[model samples]
Target: MAYSLVAEIWSELAFGMLVFALRFFTRWKYSGFRGMSYDDLFAVFAVTFWILETVSLYTCSAYGNNINLSVESALAVPDSEVPRLILGSKLAYCAWIFYILGIWTLKGVLLCLYNRLTMGLQQQRFVWVMMVVSVLTFLASLLWHILSCYPTYRAWQIKPYPGESCTQRKWNYVIICVLDVVTDIGMMAIPIPMLLRASLTVRRKVSLVLLFGSGIFVMICAVLRAYYSLVLIDDNTVALGWAAREFLVAAIVVNAPSIKPIFSDFKKRLTENYASGSWKSGTGSNAMSSGLPPYNGKNDIENNTAITSGNHKRTQAYKMSSIGRSQPKSESQDHINTATDADNDSTNSNIGKDGIIVTTEFKVSRR
Candidate 1:
């Protein structure tokens, strides 16, 4: 058995699964219906296919991989183990298909994310076109692989029957591998045009591009896999390692951006909680001396809408010499004015007592 194949699958999935979990958690934190969006749906699809690939790989391991035996020698293996070997071959076929599915779904996931980030109608149209083309190419590649050998089972069968010979052409797969690279490049380029026009600072735009940079590495993997696809056509046993790496790399690329918000959220909460904890309890020298009000167990929040407009008369009633005080016309006037004055006074008083949040703005009057 080739232990290296299993090890490859193990390493890639470990990192992929960690980011997958983070993506799910961040989506849930931001929205209740995480799976409702197309992006999340694609994530679910990719994850399902990846899990199936792992199962298929484990089943393939039951038989000896890279046994290094001649056809005669392989056929000579004990009848009991021959079935295991054939079974493993079939599992490899299934795992290969799962790898394709996982990569395709991830491409969709990336496109959907880019679609959300872009603003122009025309840009969105281009994204939709790319998405459609990507799906078509994947389907074409899948069809080619499945139907490459007549009766499909021959695609993974150990040998030809007494009369019927199975197709074992490696060149047929080269097309798929080449198209894989092209589509990956296409997916990577779809958002660059819009990203270049973003109003954000250079640092943010660079980070955004770097977020999509994983695709470039994935393209490199596809090139390697292309070479291995030929190797696979010559002999299928040599491909488990290559396919494993391709699947993992594509996985990490699609998932890399979705997990960043989780890190930022964690950092923000930790800093705010630490700062709040630093404020000591009590009034006067204990708390007010530091300019931070003492925190009462019950801290009621004041919303922005409750703030008095700049037009509201100042709470302190100072009678100017030019405007002598006049008597109120009625009890109602006195009642309303007095209540208004009282509320405004209370807000100013709470500046020191409940000054938990402060918002400032600058304005230049047209007059």
Candidate 2:
């Protein structure tokens, strides 16, 4: 039973560490570790507090848990265990509160991301409203958690005390659970209508929907956590494990999106490496820069540039030349010269499809 408690702590800790590594890597590599956003800040806070809460859970389990025992056996617990139980109970209570904060903060991370994405739309108003309501709910929940018991201190009393009373929080916790799931669903659905109306292709819309749909998985985790908490609410040890698992899931759900750009960039780099390695001669000084096999001299480089600059024309000529051997060779050369003349006559402001799009952009100018 004690091992079970420590196992949950270890599991959550490992998950948190793994996410933290990814988050940190993403920020360092993509964001240039500058101008941190609300989501970034909330992720760090959620992860840091979750780790602390895990340590607290470990402390809470220092004394062997009394979960799932007969009522009679629970009553017969030795007086010597009470002090240790009280200490553990206090730590567990602290962890419970921190866990709630961590979940809320993690939710904030996603909500903030949504807010930024919808900032220029009518739905932005709805996003702001949701954020306000979530904050108020979080504060109210915190207040209720603190004052959850009569005489408050009685809530943490490992031993029974005369003239002290406490209120059962089973239904109260169920209410919190319902609120969490509802809010999660609302947040997940907020972008759909707007995305549908946007000037995007079906493929883009579907991708956006699926990206936001990830929150549904987090909602499932919340539902399961609620079920377990309600069922094992009477058992401290079992409840602690559920709490840890729920927190880890929330952390993963919120932080996963932030690392998407990192994975995309890595994939892009691999593609570039493969393409360049296959197409370019590795022996040249500018080998890595070239997308095609090695050329002989400076003349070759200039000729290659000219060919690329007017690839559509070259391709057209090549196709025309292949169409019939009866076509005169001088006519093909004439076509190439005309294409070269057209390239020289073009300007940046009047660029055509043959011109480069210049995809290499300053990051600061992008969304």
On residues 110-160, what C-alpha lDDT tens digit does candidate 1 reach at each position?
A: 888767644233566777888888989999888877766567665445432
TM-score of each: 0.67, 0.69
Candidate 2 stretches with Cα past 4 Å from truth are 1-3, 64-75, 161-168, 276-367
Question: Which stretches of model 1 miss by more than 4 angstroms?
Answer: 1-3, 34-36, 64-81, 159-169, 228-238, 269-367
Q: What TM-score would you give candidate 1 relative to the actual structure?
A: 0.67
Q: Model 2, residue 65: displacement in angstroms?
A: 6.8
- lDDT, candidate 1, at 137: 90
lDDT of each: 0.59, 0.59
Clashing pairs in 2: none
Question: Clashes in each model (backbone N, CA, C under 3 Å)?
Answer: 0, 0
